[model samples]
Target: MSDLILHHYPMSPFAEKIRAVLGYKQLAYQSVLMPRVMPKPELQALTGGYRRAPVLQIGADVYCDTALICDVLEHRASTPTLYPPAVKGATRIIAQWADTSLFWAAMAYNLSPKGAAALFAGTPEAVAKAFVQDRAAMAVGMTRLRPGDATAAYRSYLRRLANMLSDQPYLLGDAPSLADFSAYHPLWFSRVINPVMADILDATPGLLPWMDSIAAFGHGRPAELSPLDAIAVAAANTPAPLADEPFVDEHGIPLGSRVTVTPEIFGHEATEGELLAATRMHYTLRRQDERAGTLHVHFPRIGYVLRKAEG
Candidate 1:
């Protein structure tokens, strides 16, 4: 198996979720730190424009979106299983909700006036402005929860989580499942990354202790690898064989056609490649980059829109 190379920065909450999963599984991986903002040329080279952070690179295959990344990781390490069989359906649904609704609400509150002030207290004004602008650009068409509304919703959500945890150690059952990781990351930003904004958590009892339990699974052992080196690694190797799943094409598109996959909501960058596989769960596109060689980029079917590339 090729080295598990994770491209991420320290402060990405979704990246934290993957890191924690790696830690829980005790998987050793190579780390490639990405820029906090855009113009991620090296990443774009591999992804063909899909700019999401914490992309999992295994040889020449790149996995985007944490939802699909979680699935890939689960395949790699199954024991401390993220999807327990009994509640698998519930777990996935809850994880989806947490990743979208809970995440945005928590972020809006965490980056409120007071919270943002504390977060960038010592940083230059321009740095803060750039981040805001970058995020605003990503959030162009989406409706964001206002800070006050987010606070209300976040508080309610925390209380509900407290209720869920009152009886069990994890969200679904005795063990931590995908739902816990999904829920933990947003709150992690509030508590771990920007502690000043964590006051929102104070009102909910038992929530902090649950977060502490999740945090104990520190990021697994990581060896740093430079971006150039990571790209060279991709260039040196061919994409591994894909899973043996029958193509489940819903679109009238066929394999070998050129297609573009774009996220339906935020970060609407489009990635164009030759359609390689359209399995029930994911889409695989084969694209070539000068620096990275031929690469296979994969995205989950749920959140992305696939269209045959315009001629």
Candidate 2:
């Protein structure tokens, strides 16, 4: 099997989710540290325009979005399985909620005046400005929870998580699953990203111990690989075989149509390209990045929109 190459930065919460999974599985993978901001020519090569942090690259196929990435990883390493058969559906639903609602609430509160200062501290003023602008664009249509609201929601969620932990070591059971990873990242940002602001965790004690348990599974042995080297590997190797799942029509756009896909909110702007493949879980677009040559830009079906271009 071709090496699993992860493109991510240190501070990305979603990236932490993947890293923790890797750690839990004790999987060996190639690490390609990418820029948190733009000018990521190599990433643009792999993803086209979906510049979300922590993309997984496998041979010539790149998987975008952590949800899809988790699925891909589960297939690769089944031990310490993320999805348990008994509660797969329930676990997934919980993960989805944690990723979005819980994530936003925690982040909004974390980025309040004090936390933002702590996060971008010592960084250049322009860096902070650019980050602010970039995030603002991502939040175009959605009304974000104000800091006060976020604090309340975050506290409530933390208590709820603590309650879940009160009975068992992990959220659902004795072992950590998808629910644990999904739930951990947001709190991770709160506690690890800015511990000064992490006083919020004091309200719910069980969450703190759970955080330590999850954190103990550090990202497993990561062999350093340059972006150029990684790209060459992809260009040289054949894409892994995908399951023969027929394309189910959901968007009303037929096969071979030119289309665009974009997040429904937060990074809401669209990326235009030729529609290549629309599977049950993802949409792939063939796009030409000036340096990356022709690449398939993929996006998860959830939290995004797909539309055909008007002639």
Candidate 3:
């Protein structure tokens, strides 16, 4: 087995989600810090064009999206399962809700005027302005929840989470499952990155204790690895084996054509490469950037759209 390599930056919320999963699985992984903005040359080499944070690298196989990353880790080790057998369906549903709907609402609330001031307090005006511009660009075409609306939603969700915990130690049962990790990351962002916005959490005291429970699982030992080193690792080794699933044609786009995958809402950047595989669950693009030899960038089929790039 190759080393578990993660390409992420500290400030990324989705990255935190995957990091917590790694800790839960007790998996040892190496860390590669990728740039938050463009010119991520090393990452471009491995992923072809996908620039999202916290891409998991197992040898040459680069897995994109926290949802798929979690699945990969779950398959790699099953002792503390993310999806317990009895609640797998329910778990996935809740996990998806947490990652997308709940996440956006929390982030909107967390980055409100007061929260933004706190987050970018010491930074230069230009730095703060540029950061806002970059994120606003990424959220193209999507309706954002206003701060007031987001505050109401965040409060409701936190209270609901508190209700779920009133009965069990975890969301579903005794041990932590996928649902717990998914919910934790967003709230983690509010508490850790923008505590000014997290005051609403006070309404749900039960959640505070649960957050402590989840935080106790430290990120498993992470060896310092640079982006160049991670790309080299992929160039030197074979990507993890792909499952033999048939590709389903949904977009009138078929395999062997050039395609690009981009996030639908936030992080709307596109990753371009040769469309190598489009299974029911994932999209694999074969692209060779000079820094990293031929490497594959894989993204889950959800929360992203795949289309042939305009010539």
For TM-score, the strongest prediction is 1
Q: Which residue segments of model 2 deviate by more than 4 Å?
A: 288-290
Q: Which 10-residue span in candidate 1 carries the lowest summed lDDT?
A: 201-210
Per residue, candidate 2 scores C-alpha lDDT tens digits across 251-286 of: 788878889887777775466778777788888776
Candidate structures ordered by lDDT, highest first: 1, 2, 3
By lDDT, the best candidate is 1
Query: Candidate 3 — which residues are off by over 4 angstroms?
Result: none
In model 3, the clashing pairs are 61-239
**Colliding pairs, model 1:** none
What is the per-residue lDDT of model 3 for residues 76-115, given as tens digits with 9 covering 90 to 100? 9988899899999999999999988899999988889988
Weakest ten-residue segment in model 2 by summed lDDT: 288-297
TM-score of each: 0.98, 0.94, 0.95
